[model samples]
Target: MTPSAVANLAGASPLPAFAPRPRSRPNSASPGPFGPAPRRLAVAAPPRAFFSSAPYQPPEPEGYSSVREYGLVPMVVETTSRGERAYDIFSRLLKERIVCIHGPIADETASLVVAQLLFLESENPLKPISLYINSPGGVVTAGLAIYDTMQYIRCPVNTICIGQAASMGSLLLAAGARGERRALPNARVMIHQPSGGAQGQATDIAIQAKEILKLRDRLNKIYAKHTGQNIDKIEQCMERDLFMDPEEAREWGLIDEVIENRPASLMPEGLSAVDPPHHGGGAGANGRGRDRDMEEPSAV
Candidate 1:
């Protein structure tokens, strides 16, 4: 019988049953080591595919000479492949007068990248930088690190999303400078509650569950701080796995404006005339993953 028909015949509610005393996690507002800092947060995704692409050898700009000659440095993180990593790109890009960070960001790698960027910027007082983001979204901690870094940087920071920036990625975009500088398109921007899986012995599994709850609470605080929405409202939408398009994100104060595309002139100017792929052994843009298997990333 149809679900509606059965409901009518039995005069019973058709909604799915909720388990009694359902296990719950703490909210992100709790004060603890796991709770996020209050400076404003943004987010990003992981590169689960690019890792396998042919080893990359970053190009060297010929006669790149003075930093002034090239207005900005291009730091592209296009692939989100597992074990490939984001730090590899961030560290190198930070050296440029103008740095652009983009690509599929993910996992613990994203956290490391943002941390390194912040560390570098903190040490270098003269660095002026901007960020370019295009991602689907991945690890929450990594996203948080990127967001925090943006707030701490002394130089002006701008964020522009080209294609789609969903999930944690959208959060990072929202964390950009307030007012006219922060812009995204009418493209879709998604937000949802954080989640993860655990597997272990029953006792260990129980312990893992507790940790997961703590993580959930921390994520709740991130939403509350950035969106200025009550935790309850955030959780309500999260419970249902909500996604927002560009228009909704802007209305919610998640983005500044909807733009079509970045001016071509905004492109990085400091590439080496004969620049090799940023990495030493990567095939770089070519469909060859062989070198990547044998490659180890260099210190940027």
Candidate 2:
């Protein structure tokens, strides 16, 4: 029952005393005790792809093209105004003897045309010329200049009337070559005396009148050259304001023949025989004719 008696009976010994364990140093290749050091990766990642661009291009040169192998050079001269003179250059290129004069003859425009033709002649001599006229003429001086250029062209010239050639237009038609040609059916040619305004002192007026007379002489001379008619006969015809159809013009020797079927005559220069210049009677009616007798009320 007592504690000593119970222990004696059980015969158990007290707990054994503890002991310390032995220790050793780590190897040289091993990492420190705290933790292993971080390792670096020698990776070769796939190559990257980026966008690239190309350079720009420029335009083509004159008379040339990347798409075309050959191109034609056209010499075009439009006689619309005096200051704007391109037709003169075209005329100068006409080494060909045949030429046609069509449409209204503005002062500056006519000068440019004559100058161009003369320029052509200066480069190369040509025989007589061909003149195709279709117009309601303009300035007297311009018309006269055209006449002179035609007369001195030094070759046999021909004129063909396709439409209405009225007023100073008639003078130009008459200046055609001896054996002039014309279109049949609708062709009409008219001849009337020179007309203009009288603005100046008495002396100036007198001078202007003298100029008119001189122009008349020049016109008569043109008629004489082409028709073999005297100045009186031509003057008489002009005085009454003659209008001739193709047949009448032929009978009067104004034209030699009528060309109805042909691809227009073309000279060495690129000019081709074509229809007469057309003027419209729209808002800008520049070619409308006036009755001279109506203005001469005092004489009547």
What's the TM-score of each model vs. the native?
Answer: 0.50, 0.52
Tens digits of lDDT, candidate 2, 48-110: 211100011122366643223224334444344454334332243343444545556655557
RMSD of each: 22.9, 33.8
Please report, as a residue range, the 10-residue window in candidate 2 with the lowest summed lDDT: 48-57
Off by over 4 Å in 2: 1-100, 122-124, 127-130, 263-300
**Taking the tens digit of each residue's C-alpha lDDT, what string does model 1 give over 141-185?**
566667777777775566666566666677777776665334455
The total of clashing pairs for model 1 equals 39
Q: Poorest 10 consecutive residues of model 1 by lDDT? A: 47-56
lDDT of 1 at 299: 38
